[model samples]
Structure formats: structure tokens, C-alpha cells
Target: MTTRTQTLSQAGAQSGILPIIGAAVLGAFLLYAAGFAEASVLHDTAHDARHSIAFPCH
Candidate 1:
């Protein structure tokens, strides 16, 4: 039988893992879209975003 502390520790570990996994998935999707999506779509959107922050896209 698992003690209460053991159970709570396991739950805490799982809760921490879930957000890391979620962020990894989100990052992967963004990378895929940036690389594979049509330029007309990603380019204009990213370009304007960079300029808005005074980033030199040139």
C-alpha cells in the first residue's frame, strides 16, 4: 500500500511534467508552421511583428 506522502509526491511529479510536455508540443508546432507553412502566410505576420518591436527584419 502506498503512503500518503508517496502518493502526493507522485501527483506532484506528474503535474510538473504535464506543463513541460505541453510547452514542448506547442514549440514543435510553432517550429513546423514557421518552416513549412507558405511564406505568404507566415512571412507577413512575422515581419510585422518584428517591426512592431523595432526588430530589423532586413
Candidate 2:
């Protein structure tokens, strides 16, 4: 019973974690493809953006 509970908890943590991690990887790829590395200055490319694309943020 204890093992089953631990397994479920672990699965729940992984399910939530994987999406966050996958999104981070996708975002990083997009930023690099967009040429953030060569950018002299980062500004708002899109209006009302929740976060900047070039820099990591919540």
C-alpha cells in the first residue's frame, strides 16, 4: 500500500514537472532560433507580453 502511494505521488510530480521542463526546452530553442545570441538589445517584440522571450522569466 505504501509503495502504491509513493508511486502515485511520484507520477503526479513527474507529470507536472515534464510539461514545465518541456516548455522550457522549447522556449530556449525558439529564443536561440530567433537570434537572441546576436541581439544587441532586447526589447518588447510583442505587445502585452507576459514575459520577454530572449531572457528567462516567469
Candidate 3:
């Protein structure tokens, strides 16, 4: 029983790594893109996104 519990816990921990890596990669991409992207492009993208989500950018 103890061994089974340990195995399940290990499996759960391993499964979590993929999402963490994906988030890290996505964050890096956003940072890099924002660093070099045009100001107007970013603003337009953000504005449209806000309106799409009904976040009241105005």
C-alpha cells in the first residue's frame, strides 16, 4: 500500500512538469515579442483583446 501511494504521488508530480515548462516557454515568448514588437501593434492587440473579453478598456 505504501509503495502504491508513493508511485501515485510520483506520477502526479511528473505530470505537473509539462504545464510548468509550457508556461515558462510562453512567458519567454511574450517577453521577447513585447521587447521588439511595435508600440501600435501591441496597443491594438491589447485593445482588441480587452474589448473581446468585455473588460471595458475605454
User: For residues 1-58, what per-residue lDDT tens digits would candidate 1 score against the true structure?
Assistant: 5798899988887676778889999998885555445567675767666557654455
Relative to the true structure, how large is the alpha-carbon lDDT of every model? 0.70, 0.58, 0.69
Candidate 1 lDDT for residue 36? 41
Deviating ranges (above 4 Å) for candidate 2: 1-14, 36-58
Q: lDDT at 22 for candidate 1? A: 95
- Show the lowest summed lDDT stretch of 10 residues, model 2: 41-50
Residue pairs clashing in model 1 are: none
Runs in model 3 deviating more than 4 A are 1-14, 37-58
> For model 2, which pairs clash?
none
lDDT (Cα, tens digit) per residue for candidate 3, span 1-58: 9999999999888786788889999998785454434567765667665556555444
lDDT ranking from best to worst? 1, 3, 2
Say which prediction, candidate 1 or candidate 2, comes out ahead on TM-score: 1
Candidate 2 lDDT tens digits, 1-58 = 9999999989887675778889999999876645444343332343224243334422
Q: If candidate 1 were superposed on the true structure by all CA atoms, what would the RMSD be?
A: 5.8
- Residues forming the 10-long window of minimal summed lDDT in candidate 1: 31-40
Model 3 lDDT on a 0 to 1 scale: 0.69
Q: List runs of model 1 lying over 4 Å from the truth.
A: 1-14, 43-58
Error of 3 at 40 (Å): 10
